[model samples]
Target: MFPIWIHTKEEVKRLLILGAGGFGHMIQETARLLGYEEVVFLDDAVKGADVIGKCCDYKAFLNEYDTAVAALGDSGMRLYWTEKLMEAGYQVPAIIHPSAVVSPSAVIGNGSFIMQSAIVNTNTVVEHGVLVNSGAVVDHDSRVGCGAHIGLGSVVKANCVIPSRKKVEEGEVIFSTRRKIDGVTSRNLEDALYAFGFGLQCSYVKPFGEGHINETYAVYMPTEEGDEFAYILQRVNNNVFKDPAGVMENIFGVTEYLRNVIREEGGDPDRETLSCIKTKNGCTYFEDNEGQPWRCYNYISNSVCYQLVEDPEQFYQSGNSFGHFLKQLGNYPASSLKETIPDFHNTVKRFENLEKALKRDIKNRAITCRPEIAFALDRKQDCKVLVEQQENGTLPLRVTHNDTKLNNILFDAETGKGLCIIDLDTIMPGLAANDFGDSIRFGAATAEEDERDLDKMHFDISLYELYVKGYLEATKDVLTPEEVESLPWGARLMTFECGIRFLTDYLEGDTYFKTAYPEHNLVRARTQFRLVDEMEQQFAKMQEIVREYA
Candidate 1:
C-alpha cells in the first residue's frame, strides 16, 4: 500500500502490487507510463511471483521479490497485509495510480494506497495507512483518518471526518465536519442525506434493520488513529410525531444525567455519550425536506463495541451498572451538559392531546379519526387522574431510555456481554417502571410489532426473561423500592402507551408510521392492546417474578 502524496526521494524505483484484482491492473499500467519498468503484480496463489504476458502479472521471477501492495479494494485487507509485511521486516510501499487526481493542499501520510480514478478534492487529508480506492471521491475539506479505507466508488462529502481504521464500502455518505443549524431534522437515518439538520447514516451490511426510527448508514470520520470505527448516519423523521425535537430533547436529558450519575458511582463512564452538534452557516437543521424533517448524526462503529454487557458480574459489581448509571449523574460538574425532557411518560399530556384532538374534531369531524376511537379518547377521564397528579406534583420522574429495546441494548460481539448503552435519541425523564417495562415489552413480543398475523403476535416469556435478567443485573441495586414495585404496572402502562400511539397512527391513516401492509399500524395496535390484556391477566405472576428477580 502506498501513501497518496508520498515523498519519493530518488527517481526510478520498482514497486509491487499484491493482488490480481481490477485495482492491480490499474497499478501495473500506471507504473509503466510514469517511466518506471519496476512494476510487478502478485496474487494470493501466484506460484513464482511471475506470470508471462498477463498485462499486470510480470516484472518478477523466482523467490526474490520486492515489497507488495494489498490490492482487493478494502482497507481491512490492506491492514492485514501491512501487518504481515511489517512483522516480516519487509518494506510495505505506498503508491498512487497515475490517473488518480488529488488536491495540491491535501495531505497524505505514509503507507497508504490510492487506486486509479479516485479523486481527492481540495483541502482533504488522507492520513497514514489510508486506502483511497478506485473511483472513490474525497470532497473538499474532508478528513480521512489513519489506516481507514474508502471503498471503490464511495463518496465522502465535504468537511466530513472519516474515522480511523474504518472501512466505508460502496456508498455515498454525506457527513460534515460542521453540524446542522436547528429547526428541521429527521430521525430517519437512510444513509447520509440532507434531512432535518441531522446526519443519519446507516450500515446496510449484516444487521439490516436495527433502529426503531430513521434510516442508518455506515460512516467513519477522520480524527481517529489505527482504530477502524463502523459509524452510522441517519435522518430524523419528525413528521411521525407533532414535536420531533421536543421528544429527542426529552430523551437526551435523561440519558445525559444517567451517564453522569453512573460515573459518580464509579461505574463505566463510556456508557453515556450525549453530543451537542452545531450546524454550518447555511445548514439549517429544521427545514422540511420532502415531508420529513432534516437532521444528521455520526454513527459509531459497532465493531468498536459489539456488545452492551462486558461482564454480568461487572453489571452488578460495577457498583450496580444501573444504580451507578443513575447515581453518579448528579456528579458531572459541567453546567451546559445538564438538561431536561418535557412530557416524558406523562399520561396527562396524552389526555390533553386527546382533549385538544376532540375539540378539533368537534369543529372539523372530517379531519378526525374513527368517531368511536376519538370519542373514547375524548372521554378518557382515567388519564385525567394521572394528569391531576402531575399537576399536583406527585408523579415520579427520572432519567429514562424511552426506546428501551434489547437491540438498543448493545452486547459485545466477541464475549456476548454488555458494553455501554447507545442510541440516546429517546432518553427522557420518565418513571423507572416505564423504562424497565418497555425493555421487556419490546424484547419479549412473539412477533414484530407490525407483523401482519395477529395470532403470531404474543409475548415470549423466555425472551422476556433474557432481557429482564440483563436489565435486573444492570439496575437492581440502585432501583428505588417504588421503581421496583411499579415495574409490572410500568410494563402495562408502556404497553398501553404504545398501543395508543399505534392506534392513533392507524386511525390517522398510517401516515406517521412506516408500514409493510395497509393495516399494519392497526395490527400493531391490536397486538399491543392484546399484550396489555394478557399482562393484566398475569399481573399477579408478573409481580411475583419481579419480586423473585429483584
Candidate 2:
C-alpha cells in the first residue's frame, strides 16, 4: 500500500513515535493537535507516562497501532525506521503542522514533516523522511531530497536541488542547484558558495590549485552552451594567517588599486588582477559555521599556473611578471598595508624561531639531522643581513608578495607570458630584496624543494642570470640602486631563510608545512641548505649578474 498524508485524527486513531526524545514529544504534541486520540512513544531509554515499549519491539505492537512516525532527529535513523515500519504494513504518513503553508501542487512524500509556519511552495517535491522545519521555505520547483533536513528558517530558493541526507543549516540560503560531485561537496564549501552568491546550476565543483596554505576549489556553473569555470573559492588558512580579515583587507585594497591602475594604462583590469567577489551581504569573506574564513574571486579564463619552472622562458616570464607587479604598485602607500603575517620575511625572526624549535625539540627529532641544525646555526649572522639593512634605512619597505614562487604567477595560455601574479595572501610591507629573493629561491632551483639527494640540488646560476635579466629589465627604472644591489643578498638570505623555516618546522614536528613523510621537512631543509651553499659560493657571480642587469 502507498504511504498516506495524516491531516486529521479522524484519518489516524493512534500515533506511534519511535523516539521518546524532545523531537518525539514535539511530534506527539503535533499529532494530538491534529486530533489523534492517543500518542505513545517506543524508546529504548525513556520510560514514562504514555511510553509503551523499546524501539526494537515495534513489530509486537503492529496490530495495536495502524499509523507511525519515526520522529528521530537523525535523518538516516528516521528513514530506516520509516521504511521498516512501512514494510511491516504500517501507514507511514507525513505529519505536517497546521500553520505550514504547503502548496497543494507540491508533492510532500510520506514520512516527511512540514513543521510550524514552514512554506513548501508550488511544484516543490519534498521526498520521504524529509523535515522542513519551523519557518523554513522550500521555494517554487525545488526538490528536497530524501532524508534531508531543512533546518529552522533556512530558505531553499527556486528550482534548486538539495541532495539526499544533506542538512540545510538554520538561516542559510541555498542558492545553488546542487549535483553531487565526487569529493567536492561539504557543508563548509556549500555554505561558502551560497555566501558568494554562486547559485546557478553547478556542473562540477572540484579542488583546484597546488597551494599549501589555503583550501581552493574551482566552481563550474552551466551556461547557455556548456559548463564554464565561473569562480575560484578559497578557504583561507587561519592557522597560518592569524588575521584573515586583515589579509582580506590588504587583498581588497591592493586589487582595487591595481584595477584602477590597470584601467588607466588601458589594460584589462579583470585579467590583470584578481577581482574579489563579495558575499551576499557584501563582506569580503564569509566565515562558515566552523568559523573558517572563505573568499571567492572571478576565474581568469585564459590563464595558466605552473607548479615548477619547465623552461628558461617561463622563469624569465615569472621574473618579468613579478618585476612588473612591483613596478605597478610602487607608487601605492605601502605602509597602509596590514602585516597579514607579521615578521613574514624577517630572516632574523625566522632564525630565532628555528632556535626556539631546536631548544624545545618537541618531537625529539633534532638527533636525526644534526648536520642540518649545525648548517643553520653556523649562518646565524646571515639571517640578519636583510633585516638589519631594512631597519637601518638601507632597504626601503614596499608592498611585497611574501611568497613569490614561480607557481604563484599565472601565465597567459595564448601568449605563454605571465598574465597575472596570483596568490596575494602574503602582500605586506617588506623589502624589495625579499620579494626578489623568494622568486630566485624557488624559480632558479635545480631540483625540487624536497629532493633527497644533496648532489641533485644545486644553485642554477644560468637560470638565476636569466631571471635577473628579466627582473632588472622590467624594474631597472623604478627600483633604487640600493634595492638593485640587494637583489643578490635577497636570493642568498631567502634560500637560507627557507632552510631555517623547514628545519624549524621539522624540529617542531612538521606542523607548518605539509609533509608527505616524517622526514620530509628535513629533506626539504637539506635541499634549501644545498642551494644556499651554492649561492654563497657563487655570491660574487650572483652580484655581478644583478649589476649586469641593473
Candidate 3:
C-alpha cells in the first residue's frame, strides 16, 4: 500500500529510478527539486520506502509509474536500461538540476542528466543517456554524444564534438581533436591581453600549438588602424618545470641578449628570437586565480614548424638554427642562469634514481620486465663518463638548449630557411655535446622513438652526418678542442640515459610520461637502447664525421 502523495509536476509524479547507487540517490533529490513527489528506486542491494523492491520487479511496477530515469553512472548500462525501460512503455524524461544553466536553444535528449553548476551553452546537443557532470562546461556549438560523460570541471571548447561514450576526464579541457588545454577562461584570457599591454580590439581567443609540455593559445588582436597582430600565449607546466620565475628570468635574459646580437648582425630581432610580453605589473609572467603562470610571446608571422623530417635539407637547417642559438648564447654568463630542473641531464644521478626505484619496487612491476632491467643495469658504469668529466673541469660547462629536438626550431614559410629556435625551457649550464647528441637521438632515428619493431629502429648515419655538418659549421670556431672530442660520446650517453629513464619509469608504474598502455614505456626504452647500440657500433665513424665538419 503506497502512501498518498501529491506532485507539483504531474508528469513526473510517479518517477522511478532504476538504480540505487550514488548517482541514483543524487537523482532522487534532483527529482524532488524538480517537483516530483513520488520518487522510487529499484535496486537489488538497498532497502528503502520507495525502492519498490529489486530491479527484478521493474516490469511489474512499470504500469504503476508514469515515467522513469536511469541513475546509473556507467554509460553502457545506462544506455541499455534506458532503451529497455522505454520499450516497456515508460517515458524517460531528461533531468536537469535546478542550478544547471542550460541554453534555450540546446537540445537535451531523453534520460540525460545535467548536474549542478554545469553549463550546456547555446546550440549544443546533449545526447541520450549522457551525464553533464558537476561544474563541467560544454561551450557553444559542441556535441555531447549518446552515453558520453562531461566530467567534473572539464571544459569542451566551442566547435568541439565528443563521440559516443567518450569520457572527458576531470579538469581536462578538450580544445579540439588535435589539442588539449586546461585552467584557462575567456575572461582571464581577455584580461591577460590588457595585462600584457595589448590594447587592440580583440577578435578571438583560441587554444593553439601542438606542443606536449605547455598549454598554448593564439590571441588575435586587431587594431583600428587596419593592423592585425597575433600573439602566442602559454601556461608553463610547473610539474615539469619546478621554478617558473627562474625560467622566465632565463628566457628574458637570453632574448634580450639575442636581440642585441641580431641588431648588430642587421637581422630582425622579433623573428630571430622570441620576444616576451611584459605584464601591466612590469613582470614577464602573469599569475591567474589558480596560481597557474602564463606568459606571452610575439607570434612570428610566415613561420612553419614541422614535426617530422620531411627533407634532409630541412633537418640540416634545423641543426644550423640550433647551432646558431648556441653560438649566440656563447658569450652569455653561464653562471647567471639557474638550473630550472636540477640534475636534469645528470646521467649518473638518473642511474642512482633508477637503482633506488628498483630497490623500492613499490608497484611490484619488476617481475614482468627482467630483460629491460638487465639492459639498463648492464650499462651502469657507462653513465659516469660525462659526470666525472664535468666534476674534473676537463669539460667546460656552457649554456646549451637541453631540448634540441627539430620541431623546437621554426622555419621561414616562404624561404624554407631555419628562422628561429624556440622552446627555451631547459637552457642552463650544460654540455654542448648533450644538445648535439639529443638532436641526433631524436632526428637521426630510422623509426619513431617508440617503434614496436626492433628491426626498423636503426640509426640513419646519413642524417647524422648532415646534422653534424650543419651544427659544426656554425660552432666550429667557438667550441674548444676538448668539447669537439666529446660530441660522439654525447650521442651515445644521452641515448643510454633516455633508455634508462624510460625503463625506470616503466618499472615504477609509468609515473612520469603519459602511457597509452602498460608496456608503452617499455617499448620506448627498447627503441632508445637499440639506437644506443647502433651508435656504439658506429662510434668511430661519428667521431670522424664531427672532425671532418670541424
Candidate 4:
C-alpha cells in the first residue's frame, strides 16, 4: 500500500510549476489528474499564455498558489529552485504520477517526481529533488541520493546506491557496485583509473557535460581530508575525430607551450591551462581493452561555465579570453600544427558536402526541407568569400580555437573573469576571422540554437559590439590589417556554414549531429539561417562596429 495522495477537488486548489518546458507540461497534466483545480507556470526563457511570470516572480503569486514544483531537467538547476520555493514558504510536495507504482515501504523525499510507469520497489529511498523518469525502476533496498536523475528505462539493481547529483544514462544498468553503458563498462573505467595512477580508490564516476562529440566523466577519489572530484576522464569520439593520436599530440604540444607562457607572465599554470595526466608508462593516453582511447586531466577548482549569455560582461570576458589566447600563440609556428580535421573551417567544402547529401537523399528528407535547401543554395557565393581570400594570400593563417562557444571558457568564481580556455580538440591552423566569427554566431544570439519558434530568434547587435570591443582590445597589435578587415565576413560566413552543415545532416538522415526528435536538425538549421538573415540586414552596422573596436 502507498500513501494516499489523491486529494478532493476542494482540497487542492492551485499548483505552480517553476519551469515551463516539456517536463512542466507533463507535470501539469499529472497535477490535473491528481485533482488540482488550476495550474500555472513560471519560466525564465519561455513565454506563453499559461506562463504567469518569470521564475523570480514566484513571491507575487504566494497568496493565489499555495503549492509548487520545480520541473527543471538539469539536476543542479532543479535543486536550486526547489530550495528557493521551500524557503518562500510554499508546499513543495513529492509529485508521483497516478500510474506510478510505489511501495508503502519506500521513502520518497519532498520535491521528487516519480513519472508515469516508474516503479519504486520495497525499501527504496529516493531523496529530495530527484527525478525517476518514465519507465525507470528502483529495485529493493536501493538508495538514490539528492538531485540524482534516473533516466528513462534505466534500471538500478537491488542494493545499489546512486550518488548525489549523478545521472544514469537511458537504458543503462546499475548493478550492486558497477555500472554499464553503451561502449564503456565498469571494468574499462577501473582500468583507466589504474593506468592514470589515481592513488586513492575512486569514490564514484558520473557523466559530466553537455558535449555532443565525446563521453566525459567526473572521477571522484577519496582522500584523508574528504572526497574530491580530482580528475576528468574522457573517451574521444573516433567517428568525429578520426586521428585520436594526432589530436592528443596537438593538445600536448599546445598545453606545454601555454604553461611556459603563463609561468613567464606570473600566472598559475594549473588554473590558467589544462594539465594532461599521463599513464603509468608515460603515455599521453591509455587504450582500454576494447581499444578505446581514454585520457584524464587534473580538475581545475573554483571556476564556472555558463551555457547561455546571461550577462553582457561575461560575453565580453569570453571575447577577451579567446582574443588573449590568439595573441599568446601569435609567434608559435601555426604551420607546424596538423589539420586535426582536414579543412575544418573550409566554408566552400561544407557547401559541397551539403550538395552530396542532397544527391543521395537516402532518407528522402530533402524534399521536406526545400526552403532550407534554397537557403543554402542562395548563399553559394557567400561561402566562397573567405576561402577565396585564404587562397589568394590575402588572409593569413593563425592558431584558431575552432570551438569558441561561451561554455568552453571557464570564468573565475571569485573574480568573475575568464580563467581558462578548454575543448582543444578542434584547435588547428585556421583563419583568425573564423575564430572571432564563431564566438559571435553563438554568443550574440537572442535565443537558443534549437528554439522552434522562429519569431524568438534574432541577432542582438549590442552583444556583438561588446564581443568585438573586448576581442580587438586584446589582439589589435598582433592581428594584420587584412585579418582585422575580414572579421565581419567571418561572423556572417561562419553562421552560414553552420546552417549548411545542419541542413546536410538533416538530409543525410541525421547522421552527424545528435538529434532528440525527427525535426531537431531542421529546427536548428532554421535558427541558424534566421540569424544569418538578420546579420545580412545589419551588415553595414556590423562592419562599422568592428572598425570602431579595431
lDDT of model number 3: 0.84
lDDT of 4 by residue, 95-206 (tens): 8888899888888876889999999999888988889999999998789988899999999987688998899999899986443333234787777776776522577777
The local distance difference test score of model 2 is 0.88
Poorly placed runs, candidate 1 (over 4 Å):
1-212, 220-229, 240-344, 351-395, 460-470
Q: Candidate 4 has which clashing residue pairs, if any?
A: none
Q: In candidate 4, what residue range of length 10 has the lowest lDDT sum?
A: 1-10
Clash pairs, model 3 backbone: none
As a TM-score, model 2 comes out at: 0.71
Off by over 4 Å in 3: 1-201, 223-229, 515-518
1 against 3, candidate with superior lDDT: 3
- Candidate 1 lDDT score at position 42: 63
Which of 1 and 3 is ahead in TM-score?
Answer: 3
Candidate 2 residue-wise lDDT, 1-550, digit = tens: 3454534434577888999999999899888878888999999999998889998989988889988888998988987887788888788889988889988888887789999999999988888888889999999978988889999999998879988889999999998475455445688887777677665455678889876678999999888979898899999889898898999999999999999998998999999999998998989999988888999999999788877789899999988989999999999999899988889988889988998998999899999999999998999988878788899998889988989999998889999999888899999999888899999989898788988888888889999998998898889998899999999999999999998899999899877787789999899899999999899899999998898888
The superposed Cα distance between candidate 2 and the true structure at residue 537, in angstroms, equals 0.8
TM-score against truth, every candidate: 0.52, 0.71, 0.64, 0.66
- Report the C-alpha lDDT of model 3 over 214-321, residue by residue, as the tens digit: 778887766676534478888887877879999999999999999999999899998989998888689989877667788999899899988767889987997888
Using TM-score, give the best candidate's number.
Answer: 2
**How close to the true structure is residue 131 of candidate 1, measured as C-alpha lDDT?**
82
